[model samples]
Target: MIAQVKLAFGIAAGFGLGALTVQALHAQAGPPAYVISEITVTDADAYNREYVPLANRALAESGQRRLASGGRTVALAGEPPASRIVVSVFENLEKARAAYSSPDYLAARAIGDRYGRLRIFAVEGLAQ
Candidate 1:
């Protein structure tokens, strides 16, 4: 599934971002990847106690910068959004994926699994 998503992302990049192929983009070290996570905590206490610290450590180790976190989400249209929205900026999609799957994050994630429902996605940002 992830492979398919990456393939689609590459195709979109080839056309949408102009002459820069995936290799060229990586070679030139273009824009970073932004990971957006929307979370609804079923057990706020457990999430705060068991998940936050480990996840923070993983993010720090991965050098991911938090753009926005623990922000209330407002939905102008459609159903109500998650209770909290988190956006983290990573060096690239690969880094973001690695950080998400790292042992630290995985351990934290186990706790979250019992406490919250998450919707996460990553998009390559516009070049700086």
Candidate 2:
């Protein structure tokens, strides 16, 4: 009887350790996120010269890295795409939003508002 009890206790301990390890791994593998922006610039020159630099600075400050940016887009499907598309990666959704909402970025965005329209979204990335 004592041997059986010891074996049961050992099994329970093993399961507990396994659960902890899985939890730790999950935490360590925190998923990344992305910020996507579709822009249609009415005043291209103003957006490029005045807004881009300031926006980049703010995004960097908030730990966002521009993954891709382009002024021209070719849509494979769906309705016509925006004139410009930009994708930025961040640690997570919160950081992405924070970057876009930060004062510096907001200021840059205001300038862009005067020159264009923006459609922005945050998306959670696949697990690493």
Candidate 3:
């Protein structure tokens, strides 16, 4: 009976340690990052024609998932948003930064700048 008790205790301790290890690994992995862009298009036709496709392709190639784009935003507590808003999610903050500064995105931005005003930023999301 004593031997059985010891074995059960040992098994419980092992499982506890395993659970703790998994939690530690998950904590270190961190949370996702979000990129938000607020755009006010001066010439919609030109912006869509020259900038949209290139920017979309660049972002998609960089492993970003578009969460929201050009949706109606009703401001609840602050100033109204720009004419268009785009939100994207990346694996992490590092990847978000990389995607924004990449050559392809930069090139697309160069074209986008000609037809619109853009404000872009990234924020770290809460861990799930």
Candidate 4:
């Protein structure tokens, strides 16, 4: 029984140490970056047909994870949001900026602009 207890404790300690090491490594890597886009569509059909798919592909190819897209939003305080809101996460601030300025994204944005007005910005997320 004592030997089993010791073995269990050793395994638990090993897992705890491994978790700590991972946290430490992640801390060194810095927090992730998030991109928020507020869009007002002038032509819904055109925006959905032309802009959304292309933008989705570009962002996906750039390693972005879409967190929220056109969901029902309640304003807790301040003014309400635009007609559409999209939130995405990237590995880092530099990666977020790169993704925004990439040729694929730019091409998609060109098409998007014709059908909608967009306000987009990036912010660094809290460190884990």
Which of the two, 1 or 3, has more lDDT?
A: 3
Off by over 4 Å in 2: 1-26
Lowest-sum lDDT 10-residue window in model 1: 17-26
Instruction: Give the alpha-carbon lDDT of every model.
Output: 0.87, 0.88, 0.96, 0.93
* Candidates sorted on lDDT, descending: 3, 4, 2, 1
As a TM-score, model 1 comes out at 0.74
Which candidate number maximizes TM-score? 4
TM-score: which is higher, 2 or 3?
Answer: 3
Arrange candidates by TM-score, descending. Answer: 4, 3, 2, 1
Displacement of residue 39 (Cα, Å) in model 2 is 0.2
**Worst window of 10 by summed lDDT in candidate 2:** 66-75
Which one is best on lDDT?
3
lDDT of 4 by residue, 1-128 (tens): 99999999999999999999998898888889999999999999999999999988988988899999999977789998899999999988999999999999999999999999999999999877
- Predict model 1's lDDT versus the native: 0.87
Clashing pairs in 3: none
Residue 1 miss distance in model 4 (angstroms): 18
How high a TM-score does candidate 4 get?
0.81
Candidate 4 residue spans exceeding 4 A from truth: 1-24
C-alpha-based local distance difference test score of model 2: 0.88
Off by over 4 Å in 3: 1-25
